[model samples]
Target: MIGPETPRRTVLRSALAATGTAALGVALAACGDKDSLSEQANSGSDKGYIAGDGVVTQLPPSKRGHPVEAGGKLLNGKHFDLADWRGNILVLNLWYAACPPCRKEAKDVEAAYRAYKDKGVRFLGVNVRDGAAAAKSYMRTFDITYPVMLDTAGRVVSALHGVLPPEATPSTLLLDPKGRIAGRVVGEVDKTTLKGMIGDLRT
Candidate 1:
């Protein structure tokens, strides 16, 4: 009997099974076909998780939700407090070492971080499902210097559930200078799009 405590991947499989083939097709169609994530979702393989399509959603200031308050321990065991980055635009990326989309976008994400590091734009990775060693290795592989919060138990996910649930690995959230969610990229992010999103928040 799969319950609430069951792993998300198992839950996904169970849900898909219960939905039947026709419903699965409809669900895949709703996710769109342009992005790699959607393609992977339709591949009928357990290796690929159902990440969001490459849709970028921006919320205007009036419609923006409450400020995000979340924190966790980094892989290096340093404490991270989102409140400390209140005055800066923060990019929170949810990812893990095994996810292909996460691996694909790592370099671009790192590049964006480096490009905006001096402009009051901070990038933090919320490693959702990887162990410390694997997450550290992923960072090393991509030369990602940004701090990644080790969120093995999904604490950060629960904290930001009101704004953006960490349902999809490789999701990116762009928070405005005031610590409120300004935008979201629901799949592997492109460098140009990420830079533009940060630029908009910076200005």
Candidate 2:
């Protein structure tokens, strides 16, 4: 069970671990509130990038929003639509190449996908930044086998803006079989927590 906490130390660790030594020169920063992320991005603080506060929220069916309507060309140039995944549990991970937490959690997300792909679950990545070359490089580095959408135009982000905050890289969203938002983790994903969330949806 993944609970929520706002410990600055924990947040720092996750961010640094994801960034690796090569990116250490860049300052690590984050926003506890979704709106704060937008403000930070506009102000050019830390390049307007936002790391999550390690918060996890799961909504009951009644609390979920309407089915998400988003899709676009993938890194492989394939079209993807959220609506088409309605019958299976879906996971959407929003990330950019430079996000430390995204780097840290890539392996775990891929593991989860491999574990659940044949069990009526699907995972899609939404890359908010990076061109094909950079995005593909990141995917290769992380050994990510899931489909990742190139959301450079922010079309997918705009569609999911109701639940996903702008500039909140490394945010993970879970959708129930019906395509409505079911849960979210706003930072480096805890592997056990993610698997537990997926298990709960199965039941």
Candidate 3:
């Protein structure tokens, strides 16, 4: 049976109720799932977003240094040595699974790793404030083919610069073959953008 038309307020209430139901569905699906949470964090109606240092036109600025001391291991049960990746251009990401933009870029990073892991290019993940389980799950979920380290203490967090405004989560810092700082990306980036920026290694 058809129901009679209701007042404008009643229609608005019904619309809101429907939206709430959809949101609940999304939450239920991602309950306790790290990758799912990451995907949800990055999902929005916005078709695209251009993130960069616009007006100021200035980035963190690259510095010269060797062998990331604050890096390696302090959180994970094991350790990682920056020296091992010497002689290779590498993409270094400092992120937390809980960070929205980090999740958004996780897949792109993995794809790049697979495409260049054999081309003398490397990808290293530095996880901060995230345990082994979450970090592992994130890697597996995204089919990541690279190695990651857990930096629970975030000791190297301060040393690894080159992030944009927010300068908080989803930060990407590049390291040259000699372990020196090379530009950075503060938010999610596409494969083409990454490829272009990585070209700096030649200089």
Report every candidate's CA lDDT: 0.64, 0.67, 0.50
lDDT of 1 at 38: 35
Score every model by TM-score.
0.73, 0.75, 0.61
Collision pairs in model 2? 41-48
Order of quality (TM-score): 2, 1, 3
Off by over 4 Å in 2: 1-46
Report the candidate with higher TM-score, 1 versus 2. 2
lDDT of 3 by residue, 111-175 (tens): 77787788788877877668888877777777776777776765444333122222334556666
Best by lDDT: 2
Residue 79 of candidate 3: its Cα lDDT? Answer: 60
Pick the winner on TM-score between candidates 2 and 3: 2
Task: Summarize candidate 1's per-residue lDDT along 42-141 as a digit string, tens digits.
Answer: 4433333335544566656755545666665678888777788889999989888888778878899999999889888898898878888898898889
Off by over 4 Å in 3: 1-78, 161-167
- Cα RMSD for candidates in order: 11.8, 10.2, 17.0
Pick by TM-score: which candidate is best? 2
Indicate whether candidate 2 or candidate 3 has the larger lDDT. Answer: 2
